[model samples]
Target: MEKTNNKHPKGLPYLFFTEMWERFGYYLILGIFVLYMIDPKDTGGLGFLDKTADDIFGTFIALTYLTPFLGGFLADRVLGYVKAIYIGGVLMAAGYIGVGLFQEMPLFYASLGLVILGNGFFKPSISTLLGNLYSEEPYKANKDAGYNIFYMGINIGALVCNFVAAYMRNKYGWGPAFITAGVGMLVGLVIFSVGMKHIRSANILKPAQEGDTKLSTVLLKVFVPAIVAGLIGWIIPGNIFGSDSTDAFIFACIPVVFFYVNLYIRANAEDKRPIGALLAIFAVSLMFWAVFKQNGTALTRWANYYTDRTAPAVLEKPLETLYLVEEKSYESKEVPIYDDQYRAEKNEAGETVKQEGKDIYFRNVTPERKAELEADPTKPVYLFNTELFQSVNPFWVIALTPVVVGFFMMLRRRGKEPSTPSKIVLGLFISALSCLVMVGAVWAGGNGLEKVSSWWLIAAYGVITVGELCLSPMGLSLVSKLSPPRLTALMMGGFFLSTSIGNKLSGVLASLWYGYEDKANFFWVNFGLLLLATGLGLSILKGLNKVMKEKGVQ
Candidate 1:
């Protein structure tokens, strides 16, 4: 019954905070995931090769998004949104905790599977639930703004989680850091439970319509075919996409992609144009994610090895005291000798060969500091934790959301606001510019021969954040506005399916990091991908705008 200034439903703030904490848990794990995987086993990490870690990271994220296809379908027909969310939250919480408690490979994979399955049920349902809240009088016109507001909550959680993760991991080690993520998820569930009463009205379930596809048919046709194709891709492939998991994932997606196409084909006449428009948007936006999602892989690698993370003098003491800084002492000891690309030398047995060597961080250090460290080998250099860079994109999101929201409002008042599809096309172009910034960074840093300022990474994330603000929330809002009432959740899953495919491609690209002798070319490839997406989006913009207008929604 309560409301925010009587402008929105009371449930808005509840859902906002619930998502905030959930993302806190989610991003915390992501910020540390790759670092944990590649860390030496003696330091409580998985000790996997960089290629191996990138492959798993991509597969894990890809599957997380992929599962929503089933999750959303079930929420529409069987479990309902609220029940699905509860089950998902619980599963994710247990998964987070399980990851911390078990380090063996089998147990570790089992835990990740839990998190992937849990995310499937949780992600789409919550977004759909918010759309339902804004479907009625007093709130209908504000749905886009509502999604933007909701999106900021997600960024807020993402913005702050890395610092907590740094403090936890640095102070208590990796296991405790992961456990903190589990605790955050439980807190989110509590908040969601407390606001359940206020949001109950939005939980109305639409019955299956006369022409709706049967659940049995989808299981047999989509799910079964996907499973079979994935197995075939896994067993009969010879690195078609660089790894068995990548091949399996790509093969598995064919059936799901076809399912979405079939959904458009089967839609009633009234819904056909809108569904078709949405499919086009999904296809284009996949490239945006293919480049943007690199924050967890390629960008993270840049932050870890290429960026100069030295804590400034004023902040160094406090950061070290709080355990937010990593210390590396130049000790003369048996250590892995790294090549110019930072990969360790391996013997014929494929084991990393240790010899008297400096830490990899020294490779890009200034000569003066390197000499000073050599003079006092016991003295340690304090640098910010690599995981801290994960917060940059989210920080930009939180800081810029209001500015973006206000800018759109100003345009609205002038009766000149861009349509959602127009904004998305503009977003793709802007995102491509961010890639150019990194190319500049690569040149400025002498192609990783020297460390670059942290500002390069920050500036890149800032630009992409602007594009993200324009595209991501609009994509969600568009689906809600355009999808048939009975099919909203399923369509939301389609949006994420695009993101899943993009995420997998990101991993595939990142796995080729060592293959690029000229790192600038790496970023150039990203720029080209975004530019291609921009061109595709522009080509279809007018048609999509017409569809939106025909649907009587923006």
Candidate 2:
């Protein structure tokens, strides 16, 4: 066996920053997507109902992840990874710019199409490229660490982009925030181009193996049928799954899911066990994503309405200049109370009825805190942008990645590092534990009858981030490790397909937010889903561990 030094490949930083900027663009838009959609049309928003917004959000993210399957296949066979990434980045940027420039239904949908397509090509290729860079001797030993580092870079973009999003949206409007997202993606593309030299070695395209499935065959058999299924779901009379988009997404997934199942069925014995292990992991991960993805929909609602967002008077004006503060007056006025669909309730006079208050925000404040604020001359409540809370998870990732990496390193040095499968098992249980933190938040907040402290959100995000570190990057590393060289990119795409399913499920779950009159019940449902995932993960642990050992991957 050849022993090599443990220093990381030079390509790491370039991939790191490129992914960071791309995520910045992606997450920035996501941070404010629902908020913008639900805002009044007079405020430059689309005035969508909350359920509708959540549905759109879910569908968008699902499609975004789903396309990576094709992307990875194309990168492996047709376009080299680097070229695919560039194409993806450019398309995504154009989509974001289009979103900012045009808000009408046609252009909006077109832009979304661009982004969905762009993400398909860009996401898997770059990740596959990064995995390839670590395939050599010394770096192979450090693939997990490299992915952890890369994951940190992704969060760095996610962390900072929300502030940018908040500032741009607050100062200019929704359009500019979206435009900024486009610019960030362009910046990412430029950075990737600059570092092309470093990553050139990893851009090798895999020719079709003797038994490998051809791209043409895949497009005709998988994608073509998926489109037909999606169309059928869309045109079907009554909505079986909440809405047309939801039905279409679920319907479309059938073919893709079948394709993966077919992959397992047709796989040779040598590759079968690892593929099965990955498929099991993928199935359980749907629950993880269903819960984790709430950061955009359900969790954002908590930040916007349930949490106390008032800033100190001393920092109010300073924060205001940066567009960090959302200033609202506490004066009495008639405001619409949202219905189950988050639409304003209308009266028999054919006009929207209103109540004698701005929002339930004040009502949720405890008596003591309310009285204290009422006595103050500062009638204008200054709130930190709700989107800013989206940073908490990424912020935790950045702050804790070093610690996580160090802990694993310590274990490695002691010759006791857990196998990748074991780590994933631990991650699932830990993630399930994080949901309990939110359960506490609900109880502490008097079941949404009172505002909770920001510490609750921080704590929840911190716990989940730990689980994310253990599981997410490890999943990437596992796919790279277990996949046969010829099928590496394709398997990477499969990993993302799992994510797509989970993302769509997340939207399905989030759309039920209004259905839970008791907010505690909502968090409990999330907790239950994660617990189910954790149990499923535990049952498969021993088998997955055996497969990893068989594959000679720790």
Give the winner by TM-score. 1
Candidate 1 stretches with Cα past 4 Å from truth are 1-6, 132-146, 264-272, 345-352, 371-377
Clashes of each: 0, 0
What TM-score would each prediction reach against the true structure? 0.93, 0.92
Tens digit of per-residue lDDT, candidate 2, span 1-554: 12335478888888999999999999998999988877766558776767888999999999998888888788778889998998999999999998888978899989989999999899878888888898887788888678778877888899999999988988889999999999999998888888888889998887567867678887998899999999999999999999999999989989988988998999899999989999998888878888899899989988988888888789898888876667665666777666533355544432455678656567678888788767973677878889999999988988988898899999999999999878887788788777788889889987877889999999999998898888887888899889877666567767888889899888889999888877778888888888888888889999999998888879
Worst ten in a row by lDDT for model 2: 341-350
Candidate 2 residue pairs that clash: none
The whole-model lDDT of each prediction reads 0.87, 0.85
Supply the TM-score for candidate 1: 0.93
Model 1, residue pairs in steric clash: none
Candidate 1 structure quality by residue, lDDT tens digits, 1-554: 33445667779998999899989998999999988887767567777788888888888888888888788788878999999999889889999998898988799999999999999889878988998999887788888778878988898899889999999998899999998898999999899999999888888677778757667877898889999999998998387888899989999989989988998898789989999999999999999988888888899999999998988788888998885777877886677767777765655434567878677888897677678778989987889989899999988988988898899999999999999999999999999999999999999989987889999999999999999989987888798799887676568778988989988988888888889999999999999999999999999999999998888877
